[model samples]
Target: MRVMAFDYGTKRIGIAVTDPLQIIATGLDNIHPNNIIEFIKKYLQTELVERFIVGEPKQMDNTPSQSAQHVKGFVNLLKKTFPEMPIEMVDERFTSKMASATIAQSGMNKKNRQNKELVDTISAVILLQSWMDRRLL
Candidate 1:
């Protein structure tokens, strides 16, 4: 089974999923927040996801960020909707910035570099990758 993750935001949610063996994380989609559950339901018809991960935005001093309340609500909904699946949260402090830097170095054009949706998706991948790495240690 694979693992999935979300970089949640008020506007759009960035999605990422791992291969069945959970070796690599890949950007899956960037969709409206309201569409997340339905998208996951559809995605589940074809994929076996063993666990879900959500990026937990935190402040520089490690307190929950202002958006954390919003993320908590999202998590609660996920729990109510899919109680069977396990959900995990990981620190998401720098994933967006890291994603931006990564895209800058990828030789993509300025137009694509400015795509917030692309950055969000990349951030999800980074978040999932970090989670997998933590499991290794």
Candidate 2:
């Protein structure tokens, strides 16, 4: 079974998907918030997604961040739209920073690395991979 992950934002939602064996996470796409559900539905036509791992943004002290409320609303919609699929939230405190660092170390061109969409996609991958690691432990 494959797992899907999302880094939700007001303007854009980053997506990532794991392999069927659930061992590797790959950045999929960064989509507009308004198109997320439709995009996922289209993706589902060809892929078998077993669960959703959404980033749970939290403050430094572990409180939900201001953006958490929006995420919660989105999760509710997701649950309603795909009732049979399980949804999980993983703390995403430093995934954005980690994604930036990973991109820098990858030798990607500065121009591309500066793109917010790329960072979002990488962040989703980081979130999903972190969850996958914890699940294995």
Model 2 weakest 10-residue run by lDDT? 110-119
Q: What lDDT tens digits, residue by residue, belong to model 1 across residues 62-136?
A: 999999999999999899999999999999999999999999999999999999999999999999999999999
- Kindly report the root-mean-square deviation of model 2 from the true structure over all alpha carbons: 0.7
RMSD of each: 0.5, 0.7
Q: Give TM-scores for every candidate, taking all chains together and pairing residue i with residue i.
A: 0.99, 0.97
**Which residue runs of candidate 1 sit more than 4 Å off their true CA positions?**
none
**Local error of candidate 2 at residue 109 (angstroms):** 2.1
Model 1: how far is 119 from its true place, Å? Answer: 0.4
In model 1, the clashing pairs are none
Q: Local distance difference test, per candidate?
A: 0.97, 0.96
lDDT of 2 at 133: 94
